[model samples]
Target: MTNIAPPLVLTVAGSDSGGGAGIQADLKTMLAHGVHGMSVIAAVTAQNSRGVQGYWELPPEAVRAQLDSVLSDIGVHAVKTGMLASTALVETVAEVLAGAGAPVVVDPVGVSKHGDALLEPSAVDAVRTALLPVATVATPNLWEVEQLTGVKVVDEAGMREAAEAVKALGPRWALIKGGHLPGEPADLLFDGTREYRFTAPRHDNRHTHGTGCTLASAIASNLALGADVPDAVARAKEYVTGAIAAGFPLGTGIGPVDHGWRQRAALDQSRS
Candidate 1:
């Protein structure tokens, strides 16, 4: 049999010391989806189960160098960005992504799981004006949507308005996450014309530390493997729902969803 290489997916995000979110979560999600994952470490966060203690962003020149090295040589099938702390870094990443041949997923991460500010308030404008227009899909949770567009979504019906607000920012598609809503979790995907709504049984677990990152990365992975935007979002929702169900506790605080929940289930079944 011939060796088949996996689709190459690149994530330009921060590093989570706890191995739950950021670069760690992205790589794990890619591996689970059988994609070759690459990274351009945009920032480094000293975080754990409780919360983010602190973070330091890499220099813009250094970030540019890494991006150039990756794109000039081993090109990517898809790109995803998260936790670009400052305005300068976001501007730099947007510049590079604007010229990228692959589909781009932008997760406008405003705050961390522990409620710490990740992106600077001043940088929100940059994300909306510069970064979003280049995105194939922009995945913003309720809080992030409110942060970016000043639209607060309390119910499923409100997600559409939020989606419109985001699409107006110029992405080819927009996915407004309604996981923060009460009742069942619903996500709305719109491509300026049609709308796709995905709802999953809300997992009861509270240790959903990296759900946003996982969902966005999964979408990128699926896109790398040739799924359309709607199909990609649908598949990603299923994966994240399972991962959320398999979430286990860590430390004294919230934990991350099991990125390899499917593999773990398969292993358990085989042993049984």
Candidate 2:
């Protein structure tokens, strides 16, 4: 009998000790999308449902070594990056990824769910100059859009401007997430020439801790599975919407969207 291997997806991000966001969420989302997830932890955080207490970044050389190890041996079909805390780490990862030959999904993680800072302010410029240029898709929330490009998105009408601003920063495609807007949650995708919009009913759930990481990982997973940019973003948005709707409370703070909501839903349906 022949064995088939699943597509390999890599995540370069920080580790959340709470297991709700960052590396943990990335891997869980990848699994939910049926892809093999590999990680190169850039930083480690003493974090939980309440907030991030502190974070320690690994040495740049160690991060580079891990990237080389993975790229040289196992390789990758797609890559997603989140919370690369410092300037050195951002530049190092960007250098390696420039030659990785895989679709890159960048989640410009600036702050945690509880408003704790994730990326250093000094590193923001590095992210724009060194990292975004290599990204196949750059996913930024409204706040991140302003942080990166100074384009503030207050309504759905402003998403197009934000997406264009992000695209001008050098990403092949820019996805401006408008979940913070007043109405329904919507995201705009732009690649200079073409545009796409993805929307889902706004869930009133507050336990949406890992939404950003989950969405980016799902996009990477779909890309690894051979979905084009628009198709991947569309599928990822759908999956994350379901997860958010099924979100359950955890600890005393915001919880994570259910990464395995689809699986649980399937099992429930079968039993019924």
Instruction: Give the whole-model CA lDDT for all candidates, comma-separated.
Output: 0.95, 0.95
lDDT of 2 by residue, 1-272 (tens): 99887999999999999888999999999999999999999999999889999999999999999999999999999999999999999999999999999999999999988989899999999999999999999999988999999988778999889988999999999999989899878899999999998889998899998999999999999999999999999999999999999998889988889999999999999999
- Model 2 alpha-carbon drift over 4 Å, by segment: none
Error of 1 at 259 (Å): 0.3
Looking at model 2, which ten-residue stretch has the lowest summed lDDT? Answer: 151-160
Q: Write the per-residue lDDT of candidate 1 for residues 208-233, one digit (tens) a residue.
A: 98999999999999999999999999
How does candidate 1 score on lDDT? Answer: 0.95
| Per-model C-alpha RMSD | 0.9, 0.7
> What does candidate 2 score on TM?
0.99
